[model samples]
Target: MARMPHTRAAAHPRYEALLAEWNELLRRCQSTAAAQEDAPDPAPYGRELLDRWGEPQRRYHTLDHLSEVLTRTTELAAYAHDPDTVALAAWFHDAVYRPDRSENEQRSADLARRALAEAGVDADRTSEVVRLVLLTVIHDPAPGDADGEVLCDADLAVLAGDPASYAAYAAAVRDEYAFVPDADFRSGRAAVLRQLLDLPHLFRTPYGQDHWERTARRNLTTELELLEA
Candidate 1:
């Protein structure tokens, strides 16, 4: 069995229920989004593709990613200018992840918009969430909106997590892009690690910085050295 991290929230009844509800909602959201999509839905559809990929499955983009994003989103939500929208965006952030596809961001955004529309969330608010979701695809070092910043920080929070979680994340990412030749993956991974190194801090939120900044640096230094090797 994989060694899971110890989290206070993991065993809490409220959190367990939240996880169950979230999974159910995600299933419905994906279906509704596909039905309402402007472009023809992809053959496998995002949900099916995710299911087929299997759990953990040596893939970075999976339920684990979504769960972590949500966990961190909640942690950072209180600091967000628009917590609700940030939370919504987090739920839809990786809805359309495909290792080989470049348009995953747009597809993910569409999915968020469709579900938000069906849920009768405010039109303007949904638009903002969609915009934030799109931002993750082509990340900007500086996020413009509070919700965007909050979501952005939450997505990258893994880099700043504890050493154990950070190590697992690194391994998960390598497994995710396992199909790529090792040399190519190393080069690309190095560039990403370098970018994080250039950042003043990996996380945007003050709380995140305080909690994860130092650890993230430690992880980055180790990762960069390995990549260079």
Candidate 2:
């Protein structure tokens, strides 16, 4: 595939590190895929994926979010069934994001299928990647699904960040929904928060439960209060 022009600068100081990690993950995925079939190199696709994540209209679902998820996936790697697949899912889960649309996850999954197929990834691995991407939609994987649990937890790890960071995340989300009226946004956001709060468990993995459950709950409750006020 042809590479797109790279235009996004590192948003965070650690962005370079994140980029390195992303490249490594893509390399692993492509290597495994290539082992079974004649696959194109993943470097071009990696550049294109980064470019998509850097699109200006994306406020919350930008490269920063991808970096965070990738970081968390690394931290929680031990719990994954196939860490490479989980990492790939993190890269593509929001690759085709649009805050105004409901088909983001489905579209992203479809993109994953096409890209993985073109890269000559075998049916099984590509299907796993697609399944993992779709799991991000409802974030409710069946019990004992280790990779699914790990990916879901990693994607939501931001909710467990410190107060300042959590506030920034909430604000960024609001900015993404800038087109919506305040009342409508508040109502919709509150509903989402409530659903999360009502969940029996937010982070499914043991690591997430041990480290992030409490903080995530606190952050969500605080945000819900602010939204209500």
Largest TM-score belongs to which candidate? 2
- On the 0 to 100 scale, the lDDT of residue 48 in model 2 is 71
Each prediction's RMSD over C-alphas, in Å, is 8.2, 2.2
lDDT of 1 by residue, 59-136 (tens): 666556666777788888777877767766776777666676678779878877775665545577778888899878
Runs with alpha carbons beyond 4 Å of true place in candidate 2: 1-6, 9-20, 31-38
For candidate 1, the C-alpha RMSD (Å) to the true structure equals 8.2
Instruction: State the local distance difference test value for candidate 1.
Output: 0.67
What is candidate 2's lDDT per residue for 168-195, written digit by digit as tens? 9999999999999999999999999998
lDDT of each: 0.67, 0.86
Best by lDDT: 2
lDDT of 2: 0.86
Residue 131, candidate 2: Cα error in Å is 0.8
